[model samples]
Target: MRNPSLYLLPALIALGANVAVISECQAGGGGELTAAVRHEAELNQISMLEAESLLGQPNVHFFDVNTLEIWAEGYLPGAVFFNVRDWQKLLPAKKDATLVFYCANRLCTASVLAAREVMKLGYTDVRQMPDGVYGWRISGRPVEKP
Candidate 1:
């Protein structure tokens, strides 16, 4: 015996349309945010390991651009914590330094934004550690907490 639903190709198409519409309504906002993030990453922003490798060299300073609460939790050793929200007040003091900014993780924009601010402050050498503190910790790199 033939299944009637299998023969109803038009009915299947209609059901698929409804499913797509429902899913789109549910997922649109998240999808747009994810696309924006991916686009930003594709902009070839600096990354954590790059910052780490560069740290082994002279003149590079690692700056944790996360909030104090996040910084106090833990961070890559030797990193100086600076609040991104208050960079204008803090970054000026270190404007001449070679700065690499990092935040919560790779998905975060805080570091990138901080790097831009550093650049604006006349820091010739500035980069965003895109993979951030999470990558540093997960890679078995040295870290410290207080």
Candidate 2:
């Protein structure tokens, strides 16, 4: 399924605002993904082990950016379903908390889109777990769906 945010990103990017491109495109987008990966790594990324440890904690927030159908299958406990609505509501309140963004796998750009958006919001402790749900499952961690 195609996320509607993907189509809007390029137009937003053309408006000359770096953040506007991803601000509402946290669901996913396609572009210079290499740059996204590099930047996410430079900004700060989390390992599966670290992310697992933070699950269910109040100070550490998780955002899952995978497709709704995919996410319906399973996701890390306590992870908020990231779309335009939740981001607008929850992110503003917990901007200072440690935020972890993730999608299906390292190749998936959804997480990167989310991380970039959060960073643009001036979040200091943002991190992307590129390995995503795949890594979490392979690591033998449990998954849940709400």
Candidate 3:
């Protein structure tokens, strides 16, 4: 049998070099709390420009779920690397803060998993950054890196 977690993640919807704002949602047994997440994304997905505008919002948090290699390449200025292995230990102390998650790009699902993880951790304000760093760069935004 296939690993069930993979099914709960969202799939990328690429249109040529662009990512569709909305993508289909997949999940375990087909409809879990994550299903609500997918639906909310349909209505509230954040754009690179919109996210840029909210950069200074004190209540917002950004989570970077991109692979270590991708992160090493660079990432959003305030992004947090709650990677699969060490996330539990680094869980944000604030459970009610607004959270945004992104992966390699619009097509990547790692962010979706991260979003779900936060929800399980009791975070009520979560938004999936459908377009990850690739979108940021394409939109002319610079990232912070070592």
Q: lDDT per residue, candidate 1, 64-141, as tens digits?
A: 888788888788777878875565665535555677778998788888777765665567667777777878878888
Candidate with the greatest lDDT versus the true structure: 2
Candidate 2 segments exceeding 4 Å error:
1-41
Which window of ten consecutive residues has the lowest lDDT sum in model 1? Answer: 35-44
By TM-score, highest first, what's the ranking? 2, 3, 1
TM-score of every model versus the real structure: 0.59, 0.67, 0.66
lDDT agreement with native, every candidate? 0.72, 0.82, 0.76
CA shift of 59, model 2, Å: 1.5
Residues 1-146 of candidate 3: C-alpha lDDT, one tens digit per residue: 99976765444223422433334544467655442434333324688877887776898888889888989888888888868676876656788777888888878988887787667667777788788988888887989995
Between prediction 2 and prediction 3, the one with superior lDDT is 2
Per-prediction tally of clashes = 0, 0, 1
Clashing pairs in 2: none
Query: What is the lDDT, from 0 to 100, of the residue 38 in candidate 2?
Result: 46
Error of 3 at 116 (Å): 1.2
Name the runs in model 3 displaced over 4 angstroms: 1-44
